[model samples]
Target: MADRSPEVAEDVDVVVVGAGILGIYQLYRAREAGFTVRLLEQGNGVGGTWYWNRYPGCRFDSESYTYGYLFSEELWRDWEWSEEFAGQPETERYLNHVTDRFDLRRHIRFGSKVVAAVWDEESAGWTLNTEDGHIVRARHFVSTTGVLSVPQFPDVPGREDFAGEAYHTGLWPKEPVDFRGKRVAVIGTGSSGVQIAPAIADEVATLTVYQRTPSWATPLNNKPISAERQAELKAEFASIKETLEASNVGFLHEAHDRKTFEDTPEEREAFYEKIWRSPGFAKMTTNYTDMMLDDEANAEFCAFLEKKIRSLVDDEETADKLIPRNHAYGGLRPPFVTGYFEMFNKPHVELVSLREEPITRVTETGVETAKGLREYDIIVWATGFDFGTGALRRMGVTGTDGLELTEKWADGPITWIGVMASGFPNLFFPGGPHGAAGNNPRYGGTQVDFVTELLVHARDHGKRRIEVPRHAEEAWMTMIENFRQYSRFEEHGQYYGGNTAGKAKAFLLNPGGKPKMMEAIGEAVSSGYQGFLS
Candidate 1:
């Protein structure tokens, strides 16, 4: 439901931005804490990413059962997911159901795009200004704007010259796109590109996928859950939730403590085959913990994956091009694809290596490459996003003493625990960088719970503000740097290492697992929230 108010409210205990999954939960927690909460969403409805990204074959990398909110048992018991990995429509439906079920729509102001958030020192609160010329003031400001909310268009020349229909996978159109007998060009080989290519291959007359760097992809043996399976899962929901909480990636799966090289060739191949056949991103996590840490261990897995790729694709050249050689195994966010590589076997599909023939510009009818030009009826930009800090920075957030978030994070984002930054009082970011790397929903819930506890403490003590101390912030930064120094993620030019521009940089993920993160949060809270000033 959209807000009926002609003007934005001036008096609210808490103002939540972005009606994404995190924002909805924040609203629930804030209201439960006996505070007047208002949620501002840029979109017409809920489900931030799901609402925007309506691309074909778009689905969660995490399993369906583990990707949802774990706060309510009633929701878990009532809702039944059809697939092991839920698609965009199902995810959107689930979020909408949650919103209506919890009566959260009354407080949500839809179609309200927040342009700027400025902290007023005198008022000791935040003044949020929207694009539609409305100002909202709140005692505490929480930004649940997702990491991948902002789409990053390529800096290619003459993109506007394309006369054909152009669409980005991140911001796909709601209406169905008819690709029958039409040539489609998909630029980028990330998760979105891999998924889109396979889905539209048969529909289009020709589907050309432009790849700069190939991503490692595992098979997703996605299938519908039977009534018996659903019942068994529901029965074990409590224990499953506990297992997910304790997991490093927030997914309940078997973890091999031994090194990859420790196993014989036959034993390793058998282990790899078993995991490869299993559904979802667990294939990357379940086997050999040292895959990301040790190059030798990573190489073994990479060889196995490369062999699999070669065997799957009919063309040797295509298979070789698809296999990732530059980065170590588990370096990039490996996507769980369904018939992605196999799509190349179809006569209509073609893989364009950007390294061999780089894109020169977008012509009037098609894309012009260094080698030549290729005609297409439709163009899809799967160019990915700025990620981590882009969404918040785009909103023009200003902290104490007019400290611009962009300027502060000019080099890179520096958060205490990816939850709160120093000098940003009564402000928190759930599922931000320096937090958990994978399974955002589970990690987000943990962060929200911690932030809620902090909010309650502040309210009980009559504290006007709460912020991370400068010393603690510095220590946290140092700790993150040290962790990056040890991890091999920094060696690869992937998004996890702040390498979106194809240049290796500092690692962004918290090196410690979920349990370690939870432990740190517990220690901080038990120590009278030692790092935080209330």
Candidate 2:
């Protein structure tokens, strides 16, 4: 399905830059709007993030049913998810199914990684140069290169010179990695580390997890969907679509209608215990509404989680290490797992807290800490990506009058609707900063739909270009910055583009979530796509 054209098309009305969920849909919408489109994908197949991050135990933190596209009810009902939290293999298969079902593969040119995109104002089109020596010219360019596309290695000495086989979870190899009977060391305890640690725990001779900070985690309680449950999902497709569209969090979990202290202490304990067993994001969505906003309420929940972790792990000291003391329960994005803490009880699995003894370097065989050197057959770098703007900045995109995208966004990105930035005519970057970040597909889909509509408007008005006016971009930036005070992630460095050194500390996610995004988009549409000059 992934084919590289020997004689590439000289021109197209729209050129989509990825083969992910957004890219696939963008192609469909563009073709429907009477535009010739070509989708460029770097990977050999569909599923951008899911296809690449195929490391052990990788799966959906969002519910399996909720994560799928809502473009068609027929598509939704036909495909079935095996579990509440679908694993990587199943998720990849689902995306492939969607691609083929919609007959989108023919339009996609896989292995076509866009290296540089230059805008020509005279022609009012973009000249895209791919990694494998192909030039695609198009009137419009839409970048669906997702937020987590770029893989970043830690700044540890001797990391590259390591003699052992090392792999970052984000860019895992296609062929199976051998771990059986081998000593494995996984660095970083974020979402990927939490999942892969327990998965390879029994396989490896010994598993050592290096932690910089302990993330507050809840149980996934993942389970197979019964035939009855599947039928119910199909039957509830309409309601599911409605709730997902209207939801701020992009999930269908029933929200609690009361504050944390509305119920007595014992009642609150019972409520916490009930949601503690619920699957995936239900822990956050269905919890007391005040859990995120109020400090006292979050403390109560964190206390309950601490006691629960203590109960699961046999070693008291090991259990204490797992509990996060600095950040509150919902301060940073919490990881949901099946046996992240329970794996520590396994005799072969050990916890290496970087705080007590920091890692000085990565040796030829393994990681070296202040305490001593620990050798391993493999070093799994579960370290995350350069987050929001990393992939786009690396693409060498130049806009009006030789303005590089990285240079324009050097301070921070300024987008009218989290998609179109000023001085970048006919170039829209979705699935990155300013677009909704947390629950990607649904929220990102919102911006995706807007871009399509704007394309239609441009075509109808006999316009060859579209750019957010400077005034509109300024107003949008103000709104995005104003909403920053409402976010729970002020201390969470990664969300603010603060994790990677030298990267601008800008809020990469929409602080207002879907509701506010929808509101501003509604105004733009009503005003005949206001402030869009062509």
Candidate 1's TM-score: 0.96
lDDT of 1 at 103: 95
Per-residue lDDT tens digits for candidate 1, residues 1-534, read 544464745679899998888999999999988999889898888999989889998998788889988888899999999998889999999999999999999998888888999998888899998887777899999999877788878788999989999999988888998889999999998889888889889889999999988878889889998999999989998999998887778887787778887889999999899988877877877878787778788888888899899988999999989988777766667777989988999988999899889999999899999889999999999988777777888888899999998787777788877888887888899878777767888888889888888988888878878888887778778878766666555344444534366423555677764765777687788888765755
Candidate 2: segments with Cα more than 4 A from true spot: 1-9
Give per-residue lDDT, candidate 1, residue 331.
65
lDDT of 2 at 404: 94
Q: Write the per-residue lDDT of candidate 2 for residues 248-361, one digit (tens) a residue.
A: 888988889999999999999999999899988889889999998899998999999999999999998888789997788766678899888889999999999998988899
Runs off by more than 4 Å, candidate 1: 1-7, 490-505
Q: Please report how far candidate 2 places residue 208 from its true position, in Å.
A: 0.2
Number of the top TM-score candidate: 2
CA lDDT of each candidate?
Answer: 0.84, 0.87
Worst 10 residues of 2 by lDDT: 1-10
Alpha-carbon RMSD to native, per candidate: 1.8, 1.5
